[model samples]
Target: MTVCAIEMTTTAPFTIAADGSYAARLAGDGEALYAERWTLAGPEPYAVPLPLAQPEEADTELLPLADGRVLIHRRVAERHAFALLYPTGAAAGPRTGELPLGAVCAEEGGDVRVRLLPPSPDGRDAFALAVTGAGTTVWRVAGGAFGPEQVARIPGRCSGGVWLDRVGRLLALDHELDGTTKAVAVDLGRGGEVSPLLQITEASDDRLLLADPDSGLLLIRSDAPGEPRLGWGVLGSSLPVRFPECLRLGDAHPFAVQPGQALMPETSGVALRLPDGRIGLWRPADRQVFRFGAPAGWLGGTGLWSAQGRLHLPYATPEVPCGIVGMSLPPAPPPPVRLDPAPPTPTRPIPLQQAPL
Candidate 1:
């Protein structure tokens, strides 16, 4: 069945909060720009258009913070700038920052470790790597400051890293010299020491994409043959649970892994599109599969997640223009009620006399 569309003039990447609220980047024609916050249960989401300082020339990314705030990262000039949006009424200006090793990267697990680098300056770009557990530079920006940290060089370039918990432990995907990839868990608080977990292949350029790290499970993508496949592995386990089939890479870009499922409110897991064009949710503990119908005209270029116990799917439906769709599962049936016969009542009632009479 077709669902209602959440209208948007222009939509960018969004992060779903634990409460099912969302903060997304909304871009309209002209320099009209801002981050909008929406909740599925509310009548309408709150849209806060950014103040028109100078027109932003490029797109931006909205990263949700743990404190109910958001970090807006906009790429300007040759470097990236960031802004902190407070839950109250304060907004920090765009701050200049540098990426480690001069590569395009993303923060994993809140602000745990960074992963992936854009094309290298010398033209040999590394797709995967992470800050080693023994590596002291695991944190360059501390106390809520934005900056790059230097560290000892490791054997392979890191394609992705994920923080498994709030304690700073991380799982990273390393692209080894022999073209294969391996998953390693590094204790960022300790020195950058590597603990071997799973080895996918032995080629130097094998790409390992870290998706979401929740509790102790890590969602990863193996792109050795250029076709992406989803895999789930634990921190110390050698065998990885590979999804039966490959997943659609969607415009050749990495799909963000949302930590929890909105539809299945009782469980926690990762959701993504499989190669067969089906959006699948895999619960890491039991590997239970939850499949949803892909809306018509969705070229796999959509974002899928459960927010506020409702499914938030943003896709291009053929019947309608591009927009975000929110869906909630039907509530469970009420217990069967037992009917009882009504008791008979007197046909008429006697009237009372006044004491004065």
Candidate 2:
């Protein structure tokens, strides 16, 4: 099928707010930060320039905070830090904080939770959260106010981390162990106990790990084969159902399905990744599909989410530095038109009356 006449623009990191508004980032030509907001209703996007208090370099890890602010992870050689950027004029200066981990990954919630390798004198592996707090002494101290927790120290590198629940009780860790890679879900609230959710014995790489906050359905990707394959299972279940067939159905990259959204009970959402790597908004109930194109060189690995009734894609393309490209789903297509073949042309009438004359 040919792509319909719809143009997709490149966008930066974006998130759907509680009120259904979308907040996205756009860096200007000179690398100045700007924030753009768009509504679900069709309208031209509006942007606001954000000023940097400190002359720090660009940080790619942009996460939206629950309190309408954005968290940026800044790396300076071996030192890692974080800064909070409020919307437009909400705050005077950027809130900066130092972290123990050489690198930090953040997830916003009631509090901005950062997963960073803890400061270990012996070079042991650790992950911890640096919670926002009071003045210098109150925040500067490590492991006291909001410090690092050594969850599971393995022999190799820690690949991925995600919170399994709202309260952050269960932590999912993707790490390499015994020359193999696996995803292990650990109960952090009870203790640092770990249990295997999915394992790969052969030479494989875990590309992505996504957990539904509501349903607890865990989706994982493995590069055991040349291309990525999706596998999903319930939180505590060991039996993972591999959707190898889903991968064969075109360029279907995995998109995250929000809780309580319209989705297949077995699967989530009506969206399907086409063979060409474009996302099709699908409604299996209605048997309808709408296609949306991504910016030129952008791959679908960027996280896609449907929250507050809008489809938000935090994609990075070669054209646009960073922003969220969103498009509303159009109404279902009408029934196919049927055309009957033309009736056979009538032959020339015979002139028998001329013979009688």
Candidate 3:
């Protein structure tokens, strides 16, 4: 789907805000984790002026707070602790004291923690579906205010979850039970009750990629479609979303889009397996896919969508170790007027694997 390809110069890799104004990165000093915030809007962009410094620990995971602070999870021994960094200087740029996440979050054990719960609609509050060895839990993280507070703990073992509504009220999580993965919804309004969301009659992990509240549109990649191809399903609607077997959306952002927020809705650039397994972006909106001539060692081939629907992907050439770049897609091309063309021959419905769809 070639419209007009714009040049994307490489830069640092960071998690961008809803509007792509600022970016955040997790910096580690071997013992401590630092939350580095940069203003990508100013002339001198990517400068980590106001950095949040966390207490020294063995390992740390950082998530950006809406108010520019950070929600830090520090792993000291077997005890799992949470803290809120104010990001101080003139602004709250860095460092923190102990602000435990109560008794529930004191253990960050097992295979996974919070995977993707999407930030609040206005970027003020953040929600996450935290998965531990015990079970999966939902936590509400508010920047500049409180640490991670338990909203509700889901039933059974699960991978992660996504927000289904614009106001961050509804959530959909991938629950693993009985040797199969099912999409279940945990209605926060209903006291964290779990109900079936998307279910396939097979053993597969159907993770929610992006759910657009404005249109109730869902993009999911699951092994149910033979080999985890990109498929569409509508929220609150029982109708199944079906796609051809030839398409395989490569490993892209499986994280949920922020409430009333999307990196790119109208168009998306997904990673794909092409040109000797190089990273590529698949635009589902237009059924067009393009590959970038990025140097080897791209950031795990995960593509990001910006506020304006621009594609920001990490690339590393031989000269540059790592950097991020944004691809501005031109408007969708006009459809060609119909003229009766020769009918094509029928072919077998051969299933194919497509990554980054």
Candidate 4:
């Protein structure tokens, strides 16, 4: 029997870059769906519509890059087409530009599924995962010297794409094999070298939820404690993973980690969804979880954390078709020093390894 993957379905109106610089989304004008890009790193955020002569399909996925280009993935029958969307001159002038990258056609069985991965940490490249019964293929859809290149293929079904390092080389994916799922690190630079990243237990299902490259912090979910619970760990730290009681809240899921805290991982803010649909904020230094009301027309469970502890949530309403609500968090106190280090548990993650392509 087949099992469902632990990946979160992309339903947000906008998909933001890992650097919080730009966003891409499909906007609807009552009848047709069109792609729109949002600029967030400026003094004031603004949206640019990249509508073509033809409307974009409802199922098309968009991922924004650091260079202001939006990568679009559209499925035409069994063939998956990729392209780059950029704004042209005036609307009265030439139409918005779309550079067709290439396409990936699925096998005949209709069992293959393809989707764009999250924005890469480097912000210059975009990737997609095509899952088939044989294996999962990673495709470099955008920001490639040659358009749409097949970079790596990993055995077994893999889900969840979390970049472990800042340069976008090490990727952590939850690999499902032999009815067991564990989070493994895929060295994209080494042609998808697989290594064990999260081995909480032999039988428990472990999935990586979120990662912060700046701080080397990782948010994880695992059933090692008899049931699935959210936990925290450092990328290469010798410390065993810790599942805080405050993180076990019902229906809560971590979405973003505050960046630019390389020396203080515990001080980094974590943005999560509360059980009541509101936004919840927490930090490892502070064991308490604070709840904030989500903005009206908020894209559910989607947001980004700034280095200074501000949460930027994207929302669209009649009044504000494209808007981002910024929430400033109170400063967190420094972490308390523990003279006696915690004992290492058996659930520590294994070090990453690389293999030839």
* Top TM-score model: 4
lDDT of 2 by residue, 223-278 (tens): 55455665454443333334434344433644545454321223334345556657
Which of 1 and 4 is ahead in lDDT?
4
Q: TM-score for every candidate vs. truth? A: 0.54, 0.57, 0.68, 0.89
Show model 2 residue runs off by greater than 4 Å: 1-26, 33-48, 53-56, 87-155, 200-208, 223-228, 237-240, 249-252, 261-264, 270-277, 280-291, 295-310, 313-357
* Superposed Cα deviation of residue 201, candidate 1 (Å): 4.3
lDDT of 2 at 233: 40
The better candidate by TM-score, 1 or 2, is 2
Give a tens-digit lDDT track for model 3, residues 1-357: 222233232322345554445555554345454555545554444435334333343234554555565555555544445555554344442333324453224363445554434445455565656666677787665532456667778767876556666555677677887677777777776678777666654566776666666545566777775676667654544335555343454553433231222322333333443534544554445565555554344443345555454665544345543355655555645433423331221111111122332
- Greater TM-score among 1 and 3 belongs to 3
TM-score of 3: 0.68
- Report the Cα lDDT for residue 29, model 2: 42
lDDT of the candidates, in the order given: 0.41, 0.43, 0.51, 0.79
Model 2 residue 134 distance off true place after TM-score fit, in angstroms: 32
Q: Which candidate should be chosen as best, given lDDT against the real structure?
A: 4
Which of candidates 2 and 4 is the stronger one according to TM-score?
4
Clashes of 4: 0
